[model samples]
Target: MNVAKALLSIMTLTSLTACTALPAGPSRSTGPLVIQEQGSFAAGGKVVSTPGTYDNNNPAAQGQTFHGDHLYAFYQIPQNPKPLPIVMLHGAYQSARSWETTSDGREGFQTLFLRRGFPVYLVDQPRRGRAGNSTVAATIEPTPFDQLFFDQFRIGKWPDYFDNVQFDRKPETLDQFFRSVTPNTGPYDADVISDAMAALFDKTGPGILFSHSQAGGPGWLTAIKSENVKGIVALEPGSGFIFPEGELPREMPSAAGTLTPEAVPLADFERLTRVPIVIYYGDNFPVEPTTERGQDNWRVRLAMARLWVDAINKHGGDAQLVHLPEIGIRGNTHFLMSDLNNVQIANLVSEFLEEKDLD
Candidate 1:
């Protein structure tokens, strides 16, 4: 009886110790655990007025100028993460701030993911937002504000801002969105954008690239350039991939000369087979689009996404296509991330990552 009692005590102690020793990680059961670190960084050189000249000025305008088109990133780390961190890329005419706050003022995807114990790297694309301006981006003219974004995003009818669905519905939400739009010159170099993003990959090991709208081009380009790109989540990746000839976007160069098909081939998306991808679209997408260029872009983008998926699968890559409404999630515009029930959408993304073992 004494020996039996002693053995029981030893077993109980071992069990308790095992429980205490467990690391703080997200489980299929409990959610995100311990957070280890969190911070922000510039993906490229910073403009310093006082790079070398700090005579009387401690920090203000020492007369240093930083180059533009450099990517900037901020990250939050959980003590235990299921997969590598996620690198979020915003679309054209916007900054990394889009992922941080909604037009309505609610928390954005950054908060949602951070709460889930996933490390998130939010980016301000080169020549946009905090990234400042650069020689490369200077040559292009300006992308005027017309119905290009308003109608194309399906936010509402052209020239009408208040009619469509919105999160805050308050007059302020509308103000907030328009305020968030960043300036751009002509067609910004997607290759330079990708290079800046690749530099980010170098700083922070391998991870996922989550891109929205116009950001998809650079997102795909970055995946091609960086081996560290484990997977990609392209949301509303422009026009339905387009409904024209069931064709996909041609590859533009990341640098001066194209080396081989393995590098930056024009139409060969097959090279991305090793990486997993998910192309997601929101409600009101043009399934049967018109021939009109603007109204028809969605059809092409949609077709682009589907074909990309098929092409990837055929080439041994894993890619999936998802429509918000088809899954019973409806009324989302191009700004789906800031939509009313973005939490639900975030859940879907999380589930996809887990399903693919990305997190």
Candidate 2:
């Protein structure tokens, strides 16, 4: 057993080294860096507003669009010689303002990046913050069956469901409930969100996409589909249909029950990929401790990142797997970006981008 353990350890270390050795590809230019701060009357003009924090636990007001409900975003255009623009997508249940406000009362990522001359546009994802306000109250409630399932099976509870949980209440079974709530299904991937972003770009020009968790998948899809996206910074992006073979679980829930067709295989990491990608994961992010099933899910996420790194390298794309130092935080859950030490993490990101000349 000891010998076997040693071999496993060696193999894991070898794999990590191989993954990090991948070369970064040439950078693409969005032409000149043009920072446009003023709102224009162009088709897709810049819409600027004060950063607003929503209850994130309430219903939508009458006639308000989901994307407009609790939505809060801040765009900072530096006056310095044109620098690369970055678009930040918030994690689940969070507003764009959270990136600027520290839970421990420190400066936010927005100010930090802005000071460094990187113009940033922070946005709340669909069904979160200002979007889907009608379901905000549901974010705070525990599902009856979810509670029962945890009690009976002693499995860990699901992460906060937020508006998704409320939408699932009418479904007959848990499986159906899951199908009902995932964002990629309904108004989420809809043009409204994309249009809002495209308009922002029309005013601001080309930019890099930075997204976390569930928002990461959409961010990738949008970047791949839209011409305006120059690169992507995916922080623990959820599994897309184009995942590494044997890395992800076969039984995982499809995005909104719409499984990817066999004809449209998972993304190929090897080959000359168009957009550059930078991936990061929390080293201390915890696997589900209470349930084996939960742990399996966590393992899939870690494995996916490894596979993605390998594939991107083979394809001659610029991809990096960043392992953050465990800063005394037990189980690196998704919310670490909002922590006080986020500056440390952000600095690492800035360094990586600089090293690759991505900015």
Candidate 3:
């Protein structure tokens, strides 16, 4: 009996070991992750100087001269590139790093799309990130606003997370998310940003423009200014919807504040009709106005976005607003591109590009 029990125990241990062993064959590989070219450039800014002569004795003196108002773009072209490259622009309080990696250290949209054979250009807009020089100066107070942004970003409440939210919700991930917030070296000026982005398009020729949050307004203006913007993918653009000069929507009121729409000339508005545009929003928006400031903020924006889409389609333009929840993809936060299900979201975008013939 003892000999039989020993044999059975040995057999069970062997089975467990086999189960934990690593596979022997070669792992899957869809060709090499090769890059034919990778480089960076400063685009669309002018040189500015103080009104004084050079002071070699004191370089810190008021006679400083430097280039300001330019944007920084980093490009990665694959060995075999797609027809149209993708130009990525971040939103308020962010830099090009926004698209580089997720808060939890997962692969971001930048690399994901790059692997799909598309050239990727990541931009640090004027007066932010690498392009820190600005024509105008602004005071940057070290205000403790992480909690406020935490709520505003729809990640969760200050001290708690929403049920089954797509964010990782780990302490380290939250820390990384907060640390990623960058301060602008200059004030937020839509005209300056649009001008710089227009210059980027001018350099890159025709490419798909991907903008998030605040950059949406400038993205529209850039497309209007430059014919090189062939398509657009906007993620949760919180503001900057442009209407015809005489057809602006009324201001939307919410617990957060009032949401307003910008206006553009009819000719400029018509420029957007030339390209396909898709706007994506994540979950957790209240059906009606709520006392929760964070939730209410996006509620108004989503409403405004629907109107904006209608206006675009009315003008013979191809524009769509996709609420992920309505389509059965639930629990995503405002930063859908960086959420846990970002790959799934990226697949949806890939489908859009293929459908529009922009791939």
Candidate 4:
């Protein structure tokens, strides 16, 4: 095992290259941005309490109420913020910190978008990260699966990186990357997460929802539950494409595992059509199934995403899938938002937002 994997065995952990000539980001003055307001709040959860009398001095097993399953969000509003805020949700094994700083110690999307005049809200979903309280309890085993994720994330096979990969491969950077993988404090419940996300939207009002990896499916569910989601930007959502009940496709087989697409009521699935959505994928994905599990897994997802886009567009929805390599942006991993060319990716997203009039 490499240094990163070795360290991850003690803890637990956690990209791609871009092709083409990287485009320049929008020029901005290299000065600190002015923030009008910044703070954090918890949204969406119920209080659970035991029915019994309790004494203040003897509060061990007494009747005590617990507030659990709420999502925590931190926000920053600029002097002249955009109409809609960007609420970012992290994927599995990650927290809102994923958007704060890149593994290479660069400014992350939280600040990058804020500089673009969009109020930014980073979320820690219920039972994860800052939102650790949950109605259901769970035990998180300290399994040494860092190398497993290393392969699964498509940076490269364990202890190796794809040629021309965009990730920062310094040992220290890998250490930071590994340390970012956090365990869920409770069970992974999509309904709970979606409910919490909807609550967050309810509190923040209409805004753009950004979901990465595991949060992708729940993000869709959140939009269905709340009218506050005006737009969606998903980065490499592994699964959770909702199709009309009878239109569900056959389960796809992948080297990593079976790729299962969920079915929802026609009405619920139609909710996605109301908003403009974009999905992005990074590089190093083989066009055909590869013997490597990591590469093959993504190949299947990319194929399914194409079908998903077709379904949404057919339903009169505005959805687009951008495969970075096809567009000449190469060497991107799953975490494109934090990659070395993240600013370029940000500019791309900015253009999309402007095109859709969401900016």
lDDT of 4: 0.89
Tens-place lDDT digits, model 2, residues 1-359: 99999999999999989965653211212123234462222122122333444444763443333324223356767556236778887654345654664544455676666656677778765445444432222334433454433221112245433221111222243343222222211234423454555555555667777777656655655654566777778776654524445444344332123223111233532221576787766533243332344334444565566666676566667777665533332333344454435666677777767775667
Q: Which runs in model 3 stand beyond 4 Å of their true positions?
A: 1-32, 55-64
> Ranking by TM-score, best first?
4, 3, 1, 2
Model 1 lowest lDDT segment of ten: 253-262
Per-residue lDDT over 1-359 for candidate 3, one digit per residue giving the tens place of the 0 to 100 score: 99999999998999879964632211112334567889999999888768766678766647777788989999998766887999999999999988988999988988888888889999999999999999898899898989898889888887888887999977999999998899999988888888999899888889999999998898999999999999999999977899999999999999999998888899999999989999999998797989999999999999999999999999999999999999999888888889999989999999999999999
Which sections of candidate 2 miss by over 4 Å?
1-73, 131-187, 190-199, 241-272, 285-296, 325-332
Residue-pair clashes per prediction, in order, are 24, 18, 0, 13
TM-score of each: 0.74, 0.57, 0.89, 0.91
lDDT of 4 by residue, 42-107 (tens): 999989888888889878655988999999999998877889999999999999998989999999
Q: In candidate 4, where is summed lDDT lowest over 10 consecutive residues?
A: 13-22
**Which ten residues in a row are the worst by lDDT in model 3?**
22-31
Model 4 misses residue 78 by how many Å?
0.8
lDDT of 1 by residue, 1-359 (tens): 99999999999999889976775454323443466787788775334233556445465555555455577787888666646889998987788888987988877887778767688899988777777666543554455665666666666656554343544556677678778887764247777788899889988898999999878877877877788999998888851132123333463221112111113443435547778889888766456745444435565566556766776676677889998778887777787788888888888998888888888
- Judged by lDDT against the true structure, how good is candidate 3? 0.89
Off by over 4 Å in 4: 1-29
TM-score of 4: 0.91
* Model with the higher lDDT, candidate 2 or 3: 3
Winning candidate number (TM-score): 4
